[model samples]
Every structure is written in structure tokens, then in C-alpha cells.
Target chain A: MAAEQGIDPIHQFRIEPIIPIHIGGLDLSFTNSSLFMVIVLGLACALMILGTSGNALVPGKIQSAAEMSYEFVGNMIKQTAGTEGMRFFPFVFALFMFVIFSNIVGLVPYSFAVTSQIVVTFALAILVIAVVIIYGVMRHGTHFLKLFVPSGVSPLLLPFIVLIEVISFVARPISLSVRLFANMLAGHITLKVFGAFVASLLGAGAFAVIAPLPLAMTVILTGFELLVAVLQAYVFAILTCVYLNDAIHPGH
Target chain B: MATTETAGTEAPGAPHEAAFPPFDPGTFSSTLVWLALTFGALYFIMKRVALPRVEGILQTRGDKIRGDLGAAFKMREEANQAAAAYEKTLAEAKAGSQALAQETRTRVKTEQDAKRKALESELNEKLMTAETLIADKKASAMASVGQIANEAASAIVQHITGKPADMTAIAAAIAAAKV
Candidate 1:
């Protein structure tokens, strides 16, 4: 009966291992999150292949679209991260593509939301943060630790300032993960609820002829979801750029 | 944060655990596995092929442009040098032509002056020879006139006396006639 209502949008957030395998007492089985991630990757690849296969100077529709997306993310990285930040562009671009692909794929029937899962999102966020820290430390040595110290602070206030900075710094992964997951989860849930409303209304026959309103709402919500998918990806990339800036320049 | 926390508390079950419908997690797992594979392959293609080709093309274009510019500069330099050399040769030719013309003019003037002097000296010698010939002719004529006068006086004496006159008288008559 619950399945007939279609997978509950809220229930879609649940993480369950596909394989019952346990390795060293840890269940490393493939999860629903992993499945959506694969779909997202496939979509990204197919899109990229279609885009670049023409290799036409005067690009066709697909190529132009791909080039546009690349330029868009590339410009954003350049603007926020500066020229030095260009080194991280590929990773950022990939990250954005993956998030966007996943979100859109999640809109498909019977698909799981990869971003809705905390573990996956958290893993990605941690990877970014780890890279920033490792790269920063390697590049700047002990000076990387100097990121906490503000230049103009009073000596008495320096301690409090450093503490606040440390807390913010530690909160990076949390914020990054939460932002993606929350946005995906909320958007999907809203889309589902609207979809459910239309389905329920249409079941009422002539009495619920107004069911088309919910259907229209669903279409509108779907469009909004697509927008959110793209927006979330952009936001994620920009945040990464900002974080990279911090890593490169530190306190400033 | 409180709103999120409250919402989270209300939505705490694995949406798949509901038994009325068997929630297949395999689909999700399969999708994820394929996504990872695709992502890996695409990333590889980008790193290995597309990016390198684009970079190569850009580099080739840059090199071609630079090479063309270098060639143009070299050509321009060569043309300039050729023009300079041509101008120098032209100047030399002009100088040579002018020198030749000047030398020819001077030689011609010298030759004309020598010819004019020779002509003038020859003309002066011809005038002296003509004057000498006229003087000799005049002297000879005077002598001839004296002799002719003597003959005529003798003839006149003969007619008057019907006898031949003596040499001393004749000479005296001739001398008087001559006076």
C-alpha cells in the first residue's frame, strides 16, 4: 500500500546497503546513495561526450551548452578564487557537475537522492576540506596555522578571535554537507508532495476536476526543482572557491 | 537550527523499512556503481585526451603565429637592407657616370684647344710665305722695267742719227732716261 503511494519522498532519504556483506564488522555494501551517484556520473559523461565529440569551432547546440556550462563554472572559480585558484577548477567543476547530475537524476521515477544522504555529502565535504588543509599546510607549512590570527586585533581580544576563527574553520565540512543535503532533501520532498497532491486529486473523478491545478503546480515545482538543482551546484562550487581562497590566503 | 532539529526528529526512520512494499535498495546501489564507473571513465578521458588535444592545438597556433611574425620581421629586414644596398649602388653609379662625363668634357676641350693652336700657327706661316713671294715678284718687275727703258732710248737715238751710237753715250743716255 505504501509502495502504491510511490516511495515516500521522506523515506527516499533513508540509507540502506544493497549488499548484506560485512567486512571487518563494517557494512561497506553499496547503498541507494551510491546508485544515484552512478547515474549522475553517467549523465555527466554522456553530456560531456556529446558536447565535445563534435569538436566544432562553430559549436552545435550540445557543444555550445557544454561549453557554456564549463565557462560558467570556470569563470565563477576564477572570480572567487582568483588566478591562483584556477588550479582547483577541475575538482570544483567536477563537484558541481556531480551534484547537479545527482539532483536532476533524483527527479526521475524510482531514483534515490544521493545528496539527501548525509554520509555521501559529508564525505565529499570532508574530502574538499581535507584537500584544502593538506594543500595549505604543505604549501605554507606552519604558516597555515597562522590562518586563525587576525592582523588588527587587540592583544587582549586575539585569543577570543582565534577561538572564533577555529570554530568557523572546523564548521566548514558541516556547513558544506548540510547545505547540499538539506537543499536536495527539501526540494525533492516538496516536489513529491505536490506530485502526490495531483495524484490524490485526480483519483476523485469529476468532483476533483480541479486536480489539474495540482498537476500544473507539480509542473511548476518540477521546473523550480531543476532551477534549485543548478543553483545548489553553483553555490557548492562558489563555497569551495571561497574555502580555497581561505586556504591560500588564510586570515584575510 | 531548532526548526531543522524538530523536522529531523519527526523524520527518523529508514523510508525503505516499511514492509507493505519491498523497497529495493539494489537499484540505488546499481545506479551508484555505474555512476562511479562513468565518472571515472569520463574523468580519465578529460585528463588524457580532450584537454591535451586542446592544449596542443593552442600551442601549435601560438608557435605558428610567433613563427610568422618572426619571418615577417626577417623579410622586412632583408628588404630594407636590399633597398639600402641598391641606393648605395645607384649613388656609386651616378658618381661614376658624373666622373666619366667630366673627364670626357675636359679631354675634348684640351683636344679642341690643341687643334685651334695648330690651325692658327699654320695660317700664320701661310701669310708669311705669301708676303715673301709678293716682295720677290715686285723686285724682279723693277729690274725688268729698267732694261726695257734702255732698249727704247737706244732705238730713239738710232732713228735720230741713222748711225749706231757709242756705248758711253748710250750708257749716259740710258742713265738720263732712267732719271
Candidate 2:
């Protein structure tokens, strides 16, 4: 009862500006979220650049990780969008590393979750869709519009089907961004609530006997959240490749 | 952009005073800028350096594996060729030895036949000489036996008549008795 009153699950999500900067009617202040992005950037780059520095035919641990990640993303793109989609491998790989590192880093005790923000995920999602749209238009010209025109549809339902397809296409970014943001947001909030339960239980004097239950649940949820972290990164990357596939082969 | 002042005002510790941190549209510019910069750096590094190096390493490893496999197959083929050669040599040696044995057997049989023929002809010559010597000795012994018998008869006549016997008459009587 006391834990529920004292718990502020939403407090962890507050994005405080680490270094405030205002320029030309823009508050482009560097926040905790930006710092984590840089951290993810460093980690991904370092792993790719330095881990492969040895260029070992028989790889060490770090090199194995780098090569495995490369092959994993390579195969994922190849499978989703075919070999022609390999052009977007770097883009998809960068996205995957950024998102996965963002998620994994956020799992640390006091780290900021960058992908948990709507703006951040939305930006990534919009970037993916922008590429798809630009490439589809440039490559296929007027034929790219055939994506919304499903085959075997009757004339009566064609307009309604086209409208629905367009709506879904427009909603892709929103859904993609919201899925990531909400998952991280909800999982962390739930973890915090359970942790608060343990803390409150430990403080409740007589109720301390049952504190281990919530602590155990938090541990289990952390593992589950770790899975979710990796899974979300995979989903985000594969979806990007799939959309790019649509661009590369628009008829399907 | 107009809400920059409002968000800047909310930049303090009490961020929730105005809006939930994520939904606050004012922070978009900052976050997007950072995303673009970091993501752009990652892409540049990946495209220029990381991906190519890994691809090269993979390519080298693949070539090495194929080379090693080819070498193994070549060695096996050489071994098979060597084994075949060895088998051929062994068969040739076996045939050669058999021919040598057959040649030795035939030569030894021919030598034995010559030696046996020489011994048989020499034995036949020796047998003929021995038979001639035995016949001459038997003829001489028979002449001596006749002389002894004539002497005994002369001596007996001398004792009975108290007179010498005649040699020519005796010889004539002996010849008549022999007939």
C-alpha cells in the first residue's frame, strides 16, 4: 500500500538536458538521451572497427562477435529483400546496432533508454520509410503506385482497398515507432514498479519476509526484457529490409 | 520551433511540470540532430572501412579452405598412383622370380641328364673289359689242369712198369681221350 503511494514509475523517463543549448529559436540542448546515442554509436563503431583490427582468419571473441553480427544482418537482408536488397545492408546494420545497443545499454541500472522516446523511434522509422519512398519512386517511376493496387480486387472494392492500403502505408512509421517506444517504456515501468514493491516491502518491517518475491519477479522480468531488447532490434531491422524489398520489387 | 522557449523553460529537473519527456515535441530537434550525426558517422565508417575488411577476410578464408581441400585431394590421388605403381612392380618381380626359378630348374635338369649319360657309357666300357679278362684267365686255368693230369698218368705208369713213358705217345693218347 505504501509502495504504490511513493512509487513514481514515470520519473525515470524524464529527459533532463545535460548541456543546455539554444540557437536561432531552437532548443537543441544535448540531453541524457543524446549521450546514450553517442554511446551506442561508439560501441557499434568500436566493435566493428577495432574488433576486426586483427582481421584474423581464426577469430578471437570480439572478432567473432563482429563477424557474426555482420553475417546475421547480411543474411537477414538477403532473406527478406533478396540479394539486390544488399545495397541497404549498411543502413540496416547501423540501425540494428544502434537500436540493440540503445536497448541493451538502457537495461543498465541507471542508464537512459533512448529508443523509449517517441521522437527517437519515430525519427528512425521515418528515415526508413523515406528511403523506401524515394527509392521506389526513382526506380519504378509511376509503377511504384502499384503497391497500393492489390491484384484480383473487384472494381467496386478497388477504391476502398486503395484507401486502406494508403492509410496503412502512412501509419507504418507511427506503428513502428510506437511499438518500440511503448515496449521499452512499459517494460521499464513494470520493472521499476516491481523494484519499488521490493523496496517498499523491505521498508515495511513485517512485510519484509515477502520482499524476495518481487525481487525474484524483477530478476525474471529483466531476463525477459533482455530478450525483448534483442527481439525488438531484430524486428525493427527485418521490417526495414522488408519495406526496402517492397521498394526494390514493387509489384509484390 | 516556436515551442523551443516552452521546452527550454521545461529543461530543468522538473521536466514533468510541462509534459511527459518523450512526447514533448520540443526535444525532437535535439534528438534528431544527434541521431543524424551518430547514425551518419556509423554509416560512413561501415561503408568505408568495416564491411570491406570483413568481406576480404571472409573471402581469404574461403579461398584458403578450397585450396586446402584441393591439396588434400591431390595428395590422395598421388598416393593412389604410387600404390598402383608399387603393385605393378611387385607383379613384375613375382613374374621375374618365377621365370628365374623355371630357368634354373630346366638348366639343372639338362646338367643331370648329361652327367647320367656319361656315367652309363663309362660303366658299359668297364663291364666289357672285365668280361674279356675273365674269359682269358679261364682258358689258361683249363690248359694247366690238362698238363697236371698228364703228369699224374706218366708217374703211375713208371711205378707199375719200371720204365720211362714216351712224351709224343702220351700226348697222342691224351688227345684221343679228350675226343
Candidate 3:
């Protein structure tokens, strides 16, 4: 346990560059994170492209998956954001696929989780907010500022309510980013810790008897992580739709 | 583990950030770049190729189902029309046959009545001739019976008297007896 660096739960998130490319003071090097991002990209696109390649009227398993994913995102957008919010369907679908694929691909024994990085989640969250802001302002002009003001609040408490609303509005990206990052980071760390516990127990002499306990815990956590992975992706997509809804129809 | 070892061997950028990777600002640029590249590519592929194909498949399936329903409905309607025509033809033929049977019945009845009338008239004519012959026979028989009586009376009287007796008396007696 003293010398095992593999057991360091935080070590798995380390980003070592596979291809170091430096351009204009930016470390645009492709790291393990980037590799896995590409992997996620490949996985997601492959599922979509290959699954639909046959274009079968009666879909095969893979084709059903592809169709289900499309309808899943499509219906999500329609239900949360309404038909008008369909303009952002491509973006929302992309985000959902990326996150879900990243989560799933990361579950591989030695793979790095791209979403565990806060910067990555923050970037995606920022993108959603940026769309909301840019399109909201462009479409509704000053009326978009009405998003901060409640329609039915008494004028006496309006200032406080508006302040709270502004804070909440500003916190959306932070909350959105942190929510996903924290969940992935915590879940992975727990998995790593428990896995190390099992390994450590197996390496121990008499304590090896209880190795099944941690192993079982790891197995259960893995299952839970799979759920979290999918649930988080759903949460991400649905929230994106809700935000896009504001962009399409501002206020109230 | 290979990745972690590789990270350790890489030029240690900073001691502080190296302890925890998520907080490291050093990898932000690369992460962001990759996110943008990958997400942009996904969006592009989905929008341009995959989604549209799926949408097209669903649309085609829907159209095919609707077409099948329409064709079935059309066939059913045609069947109904044919059945109706069959029923009409059957009713028409039934009515025509019934009318024909009625005509045959009336014609046969008329012919039978005419033949019976003819037979009855012939029988009546034969009966009238027979009656007239019987009447003539009776009258002749009556005249013959009177002659036989007159002879029998003359023979008896001649035998008893033993004489040719009085012709005038005899003639007068015979006349009174005839009366």
C-alpha cells in the first residue's frame, strides 16, 4: 500500500500528452483526455452512421439504437423546449451523445474519463449558456432582460427577487458544470478507491478473506456508475433543452 | 496505469497542479479544443447525415402503412360493390323466373278449359242422337203391338164360331174393340 502509485485515486485523471503540439503559447497538445474525446466522438458518430447505414424500414438492433437515440433527443427537445426549440436539436443531440459516450468509454478499466475534468464540463456548460445569451438577446433584444424580472412579484420585494434571480441565472453554468463534473469525479474516485481496496486486500495475507466485500462494492459501484453515466447524459440534454427554451421564448 | 506513469515521466509542469488533475489549468486549452472539435464534428455529422436518414426511414414506413391501409380499404369497397351487384342479379333473375312460371300456369289453364268445353259439347250431341233413335223405336214398337192384338182376336173368334160368320158384325165388333 505504501509504494502502490496505481492506488492513488487521483492519478487516473492525469492528462499526459500523446502528441505534444504547441502553437502560439497554447498547449493544444492532444492528451489522454483528447484521445478519449476523440474516442467518444468516434463511438457516437459510428453508432449513428453505421446503425443507420442500412436505412432499414424495419430496424436491426443497432439501427433501433440509432433511431431510439434520435427520437430520444428529438422528443426531449420537443417536450421540454417545444417545437420552436428544435433549432438547437443538433447541438443538444451532440452534447448528449458526447457526454454519454465519454461516460461509457471511460468505464473501461484503464480509460480516462473526459467529463471528469471540470474544464471540459465547464466548457460545455458555457456553450449552452452562451447560446442562451446570444440567441436570446438577438431574438428578443432588450426584452430578453425580462428573464431576470418576475412577472407577478410585488414591487416591494421585486429588488430582492430580481437579485436572487440574477444570481441564480449567473449560477446556471457553474451549477451545470459542477454538477456533472462532481458526479463523475466522485463516482470515479469511489470506484478507484474501492478497486484499490480490493487489490490491497487481495495482496494482504489473512485480510484477503474479506477481499470479496470490496470487490462486490466495486461491482455495485460500477453498475451505479453506468446508471449515473446515462442519467447524467439525460440530465445534461434535458437541461440544455430547458435553457434553449429560454432562448427561443424569453421570460416567465 | 500506463497513462498515469506516462504523465509522471512527462516534464513536470507544476508541483501544485500535479497533485490533482481536475484543478489543473494547464490542460484546459487542450481539453477545450478537443471538446469543440469533437462536439462540432458530432453536430455536423448528425445534422448532415445520420438524423436525416433516420427521419427518412420513419417517414417512408409511415407512408407505406398509410398506403397499405388505403389499398385495403379500396379492395373492401370493391368487394362490397361486387356483392351488391351479385345480390341484385340474383333478385332480378328470381323475379323473372317467377313471372315466367306465372305466364306458363295461365296458358296451360286456358288450354285445359278450352279442351274440356269441346269434349262436353261433343258428348251432348251424341246424347241427343241416341235419344231421338230411342223415341222412333218406341213408336214403331207401339204400332206393331196393335196389329199383333188384332190378328190374335180374329183367329180366336173364327175357331170358336166354326163359321165364316157375319162379316159386317165382325167388322163392326172389331172397330168397337179398336176404340
- Each model's TM-score? 0.62, 0.87, 0.83
Would you list the rank order by lDDT, best first?
2, 3, 1
Q: Which scores better on DockQ, 1 or 2?
A: 2
State the lDDT of candidate 3 residue by residue for B39-154, as single tens digits.
Answer: 87888998898888888988998999999999999999999999999999999999999999999999999999999899989988898888888888988987776666656666
Q: Residue A126's C-alpha lDDT in candidate 2? A: 84
Output the lDDT of residue B100, model 2: 100
Off by over 4 Å in 1: A1-7, A14-26, A30-32, A205-207, B1-45, B53-179
User: Which candidate has the top score in lDDT?
Assistant: 2
DockQ of candidate 1 relative to the true structure? 0.06
lDDT of model 3 at position A236: 88
Which has the better TM-score: candidate 1, or candidate 3? Answer: 3
Across residues A8-115, which tens digit of lDDT does each residue of candidate 1 receive? 656656555675543343333566665566667667766666566766645678666666666787789889878898787667777777788877887776687777
Tens-place lDDT per residue, model 3, A165-193, is 89998999999989999999999999999
Best of the two (2, 3) by lDDT: 2
DockQ score of each predicted structure, in the order shown: 0.06, 0.42, 0.37
Residue A153, model 3, lDDT = 92
Give the per-residue Cα lDDT of candidate 2 at B108. 99
Candidate of highest TM-score = 2
lDDT of 1: 0.70
lDDT of 2 by residue, A1-252 (tens): 223346777777777689988776666688888898889989988898899999898999998899999999999999999999999988899889989999999998778888998877887888889899999999999899999998899999999999999999999988888999999999999998998899889999999999999999999999999999999999999999999999999865
What is the clash count for each candidate, in the order shown? 6, 0, 0
